[model samples]
Target chain A: MNFFLGIKIFFRSLFLQSVWNYERMQNVGFVFSLIPFINHLYKDKTVRAQKIKTHFGFFNTHPYLANLLLGIVMRLEEKCLKNEVSQEEVLRTKTMLAGPIAAIGDRFIWSTWRVVCSFIGVAYYLCSGKEGVWYQANIFVGILLFLLIYNLLGHLPLRILSIYWGYKYTNNVVDKISKFALQSYIVKIRNVGIIILLFASFIYSISLISDLKIVLLFWLNILLSLLLSKKIAEVGIFYILFLLNIIILTVTNL
Target chain B: MKLSLWFLFISTIAGLFHLDVMVFGQFMFSRPIVVAPIIGILSGLPEVGLIVGIITELLYVSIIPVGIKIPPDSTTVAVLTVVCSERLIDIPVALFFAIIFGFLYKYIDIAQRSFNSLLLGWVDTAKAELVEQRVNLLIIYALFITYLKTVLFYLIVLPILSFFIKQVFCCWIKNLWVHMDLYNLIYILPAIGIGIGLAHFVEE
Candidate 1:
């Protein structure tokens, strides 16, 4: 019976809310959070549905950002749904919070932290070799750490902030945090230099042993990019590369 | 189940890096990623899986389900690529084969829409039946059709292509192959241009 209920929730979350309302992605995150509690609520369908809907409100998160959004929304949704808040009030709370959460969550957790963790993982793999259980554990642990801290910071603020200043206040808090992070000195000039260095090195490395006249490839790339920049959105460069690849292979007998 | 297993694996890896770009790690296991990878992993090499993933990812990058415009069927590309790559009896054949495979994937999506129409018809009948069992049956049928669409795509198309490529195609005048280094260069130039374009022209 419990299993059936769980499946029903999964199906509804996945199909009904996701498809009909066209917000299925968010519902999937909500269902993921509710999965643990689901097994415990075997007999009570009413409470199960209520609890699921309550959490389902946190749904708008990107898949990778799911944990953070899930963590925060889970806490915040519970409070808002329980209050005598109007529907507009509820929605206003969600909209205001979602963008701010998305910004901080994207920058710190998704962009910066993920880069750091992946770099650490890559370094570990390079240094220690990719074979051992330890390496595997390190990779797994790195990912888990990302999920943990991201979700914790993402979720924890809602509880404290919502309690103190209502839901809208939490949005400003998230904004301030994001603004501070973005404006940090490290994000200024040095980051620009690093980006330039990475690109130059990347292109130089690619120029090695390529038969298709490096200059031609270079020109085509520039032209295509110029087109892309001008918003002439179409598949140009890829097909050009394809045609050029065929011509080069034919001529060079490669 | 076999098809689904394939889809999940392929999509997971493909979506892993790229989806990180936009959603910044959100919505990885959604429809396109889920479907595209399923096709590549099941029948072709990981390279094919990766290629198909990249192609579909780029194709769909600007398309968001913000309003109408249901995005093109990305799963079809994976499924067709795997099928063509296996059947065509060539590893580094023209990228044209990929375009062909991509086109075929779109057609299969048309078939899916047809199937959806039939399923909707059944949903109406079930509603009319006033029997709760019909609702359950309809749900089961929908699930079955989703699985069926993915499996039949590989099982049917791959074997036929494999036979045709192996028997008929000849290795004549094969030369214009782009080296991997050049391929990397081709990919990178745009990033540099974009960087330059944004920095030089566009005001932040």
Candidate 2:
């Protein structure tokens, strides 16, 4: 029954953003995902309703990492039902875990992992070039490979393990997670991977530019844009570069 | 460049899934790199889709939603760029309009989320009444609102933008394309994208 409940919650956790609101942020979805476990633990309808109401309070975190919280909460709730733990304790645990977990998830998954995967994807597509009988096929493969690698390798394992370990070690799960050392390794690997991909893409871009003057201009433009990106919003820089291109083209034609 | 109903329908569904499923499943399909190519392939212009996707993806690499602050909606920007570019306007022009609309849609998303808070009052009342089913109903309502927003955005914007490009700006764009070496322009956009991507690492 515990195994079934964990799997059910995992599936429901996917809908973590369905009813996202400013007041409570992922509260409804979080509660909804844990409904099965809540029902299983609290046999009485009123108790079940009470437990659900308790979860309806403000709860926001990265959606992916929320599964880990859900697993840990389920274990705590089970203990609470057995009079081994208090309701306040479970609520406090949820509140404590939300922020740190969100920070780790936002940094590692959103920033580092995603950036690495995208750089690699772009590099793959660029290197493939727009030629040959299988050019279109190559592009499709490159895009799919990025999606597969990101979802399969990066996201799925983290989510599954978080859920599993959250259940296995309900007490001090956060400390265990913090001391895991796997995340640091992943970040290190991602940093190295991004650097390699950037160099590859730069070399490829250079090869494509035959004219030395144009190549120098390209590097100059890249440097200027990089400096501008710090001060200006991305969209702003995009518009400026775009207008510059139009103006340059118009002048060259004139 | 006639628009196909099938392409429009598929793109809308893809847009819906990109936001909806991506949020739920944590799949990166919502990213421009993935969404653009899928839309491009469906529209029978995979190359344009791939190019637009890469540029948009790189440009918006740093725009992750860290906490409460919402990033400008890159997925919408990408889908609209590819779909609109299929008609006739240059990819950059399509991208420009898409970026504009993307910001517009971002505001709309914020408004929608704010509006959703009103629904929570109903949820509270339902909880008081002990009608837990109402909460589920409200969730479905919220999801529907999200779906409707995407569908309506595409249904209204793509055709109008395509028409405007075809009617008013056609000759101007054509003239620009004729006079300009587009190859050089293409190289410039990606270079900026690469620079932005690299900038994130350098900062860290």
TM-scores for all predictions:
0.50, 0.92
RMSD of 1: 9.5
- Candidate 2 chain A, which ten residues in sequence have the lowest lDDT sum? A128-137
Cα error, residue A91 of model 1, in Å, equals 4.5
Q: lDDT of each prediction vs. the true structure?
A: 0.39, 0.76
Tens digits of per-residue lDDT, candidate 2, A1-254, equal 36676778788787788777788888888888888887787678777777778888899998888888888898888788788999999999999989988998888888888888888788777665433221334667868778888888888787767787877787677788778785777658667766766675666555656655446655766787788878888888888878876676567667
Considering just the first chain, candidate 1 attains a TM-score of 0.46
- Which tens-of-lDDT digit does each residue in A147-243 have in candidate 1? 4543355433432233333223443445554556554633443354335334533443344325346545545554554455344432344455445
- Among the numbered candidates, top TM-score falls to 2
Q: What's the residue-level lDDT of A237 in candidate 2?
A: 82
What local lDDT does model 1 show for residue B110? Answer: 46
Where in model 2 is the C-alpha error above 4 Å? A130-137, A211-214, A252-254, B1-11, B21-23, B87-89, B127-131
Q: What is the C-alpha RMSD of each candidate to the true structure, in Å?
A: 9.5, 2.6
Output the worst ten-in-a-row residue range by lDDT, candidate 2 chain B. Answer: B15-24
